[model samples]
Target: MSAKRMQLFAFFISVTLIWGCQLEEQEFIPDVSGIEAEVDIRRFDQALFQLDTNDMQPELQKLMEAYPELSTLYFTHILRANDPRTAPDGPAPYVKGFLQHESVRNLYDSVQVHYPNMSDIEAELEQAFRFFQYYFPDEPVPNVSTLISEYAIAAFVYGENDLGISLDYFLGQDYPYQKLNPRDPAFSAYLTRTFNREHLTSKAIQTLINGLVPPARQQRLLDLMVNNGKKLYILDKLLPYAPDSIKLEVTGPQAEWLEDNELEMWAFLIKEDLMYETDNRKIRKLVDYSPHSPGMPEEAPGRTANWVGWQIIRAYMEKHPETTMQELIALEDAQGLLDASRYKPGR
Candidate 1:
C-alpha cells in the first residue's frame, strides 16, 4: 500500500478506537481525559441529577416553546456549571469522539441509579434536536455545523490541526480548551460571564450550537444544508448580529462572480458561517465584520457555498459505494474536492 493509503488505514482505525466513549455524551466537560478529567464527569453529571427539576420540564417548555435550543440552553448550562473546565476551544469536537475507554461508562451506567428521569430525557432531547443542521453561526444554531470544508472541521471539530496539533496553536488542544483549566480561578469566573445569555446575542447563540452538535454530525450536516438548496437558509442573513470584532471586504465583482456558481455559493456560505467568531481574517469578507473564514488575502474557492465540493464528492461516493476508503479520504479536502472538476468556482 502507498503512504496515502496508510494514512487512510490509520484514520479508519482511529475512528474505530473510540466506541464505548460516546463523545456526544459531552453535554459538558472537556475532550481530554487522564488528568483528573474524569472528576468533571462525576461532579457535573451528579450535579445535574440533583437539580430542582421538579415539574420544570413543562415550565421549561414555555421558554423553548419554539426550538430545542431553548430547552438545550438551561440543561447544558446545568452541565457546564458542574464541569467547569472547557471554553475557547469549545466542546463540540469532543462530542464526536468515540467512547474509546471504559472510564466514563459508569457515568452513563449510573444515570438511572440516581436520576431516573434523566435516562430517557437526555435521549429525548437529543432526538428533538436531530431535525435541523447544527453548526457554528453568529445566530442561534439550527442544528448544523459551521465548519464547512474539512479544514475547520478537522481542527475545530475533529480535534486535528492539519498543520498538526501544537502547543503554539492558540485554540489550545481544541477540546480541552473548552473544558477550562481545572487549575484556574478564571474557569469559575468565565462561566458566569454570560450576563448576556438571555438576549441571545449572535456570539452566544453560535457557542450554544457548537456545544450541542458533534463534528461528525456536523460533517454529514454540511451535506444536508447543501442538499437542502445550497442557498435558501433564512438564518444566513441574521449572522451579522455578531459584533464587528472580525472583519473583511468582498467586492461586488466577487459576489457576482460567486452568484453564477451555486456550488461555490454553497461552499462559501458554509465557510463563512464556520468562522462567525474567529479573527484570522483568511476568508473573503462578504459582509461587514463577517468574512469567508479561514481568512486569506483574496479570491478563494467557492465564495458563497463552499460545501458544494464536499457534497459532490459525497454524492459520488453514494453512487459508487465500491470506492475504497483511501479513495474517499483523498477527496476529503477543499482542493481535492474541487480538483475533481465537479466544482467550477466563479463559474
Candidate 2:
C-alpha cells in the first residue's frame, strides 16, 4: 500500500478507539462529589472494639466522652439491642455484659479480620447518599453509624436522622456461623445472598426507600408483585453502580435463570390464573424468600413473581417514558400498569 493509504487507515483506527473510550466513559455511576451533604460516618464498632479489657469501664467512658455521637448511639441502639430490658440511664452493666458475650466477641474478631479497611464501602455510602440528595434534595441525609447487632431481628435499621448498620449481619456470605447452620430456617435465602460488604450500601438504600413506600399487605398477588417491582425499579435508578445481583437481592445464577425463562414463567402464571389469586400459601411460594419457587421447575429460584413484576414495570416505563419517578411511586393500580405495559414476553 502507498504511504498516503497507510496514513488514512491509521487515522480511521485512532478515531474508532477514541469513540470506544468515550462510550465506555458514558456508563454512569453516582458522582459522590456532586452530592451536597457533609454527612459524617461514625464507626461505633471500631470505637467499641478498641476498648481495653484491663480498663474497660474507663476506656468506654473516655471514648463516649470524646465522641458524644457514639454515646447517643449506644443509648439509642446498642443498649436496647443487647437487651430490651436496657434503659438509657442504666447502660454500663449491659454494655459490659454485651462485650463479655462470647458470640459478640467472636463477631467483633471476625469483622476486624474480614473488614479491616472499609474505605471502599465508605466511598460507596457517599455515592448512595449523593444519589439520595439528587433525587430528594429536601430530605435530610441521615448520619451513618456502624455497630455490631448481636444477631438482631433487623439488620439495617434507621430513623429520620440516623441510619445504623449492624456490622455482624454483613460479614461475607461464607461467614462461619452461616456455613455451620446452612439449613437454619430463620436465615432466609435473601438474607444469606445479600450478606456481604458489596450489599451494605444497597441494603441501606433499600431500607431508606422502604420507609417512603408503605408496604403492600393483604393485596392481590399481582398488586404485591407490582409494588415490589416498583421498589426494585426505583433501586435500579438509585444504585446504578450496584451489581444486578445485589439490586435484585439474588445470586447470579438465579438472575440468569429468571432472564432466560421470562416468557415461560409469565405463561405459567397466566395459564394458572395466579395473578388475581389471594391464597397466602400460593402467593408466598412465588413472592417470599425460599429455596426455590414452588410449582415451577425445581431449578427456578423463589420470587419469580417479583421478576415478572419487574419486567412488567420496566415495560410500562419504556412504553410510557414521560412518567416521572414520583408518578410511578404513586401508582397503585397494578392491573393498570400491566395493561399499559402491554407486556408480551418473547416479542
| Top model number, TM-score | 2
Worst 10 residues of 2 by lDDT: 19-28
Candidate 1 stretches greater than 4 Å from native? 1-45, 48-121, 124-305, 324-327, 330-336, 344-347
Q: Taking the tens digit of each residue's C-alpha lDDT, what string does model 1 give over 285-321?
A: 3221233323433443223333333334544444565
TM per prediction = 0.24, 0.79
lDDT of model 2, residue 38: 57
> What tens-digit string does per-residue lDDT give for candidate 2 at 191-301?
675777888888887887776666764478888888888888778777886777788777888777887787677767765767777888888868877778878997787
Q: Which regions of candidate 2 deviate over 4 angstroms? A: 1-33, 37-40, 51-89, 179-183, 188-193
Backbone steric clashes in candidate 1, count:
38
lDDT of each: 0.30, 0.72
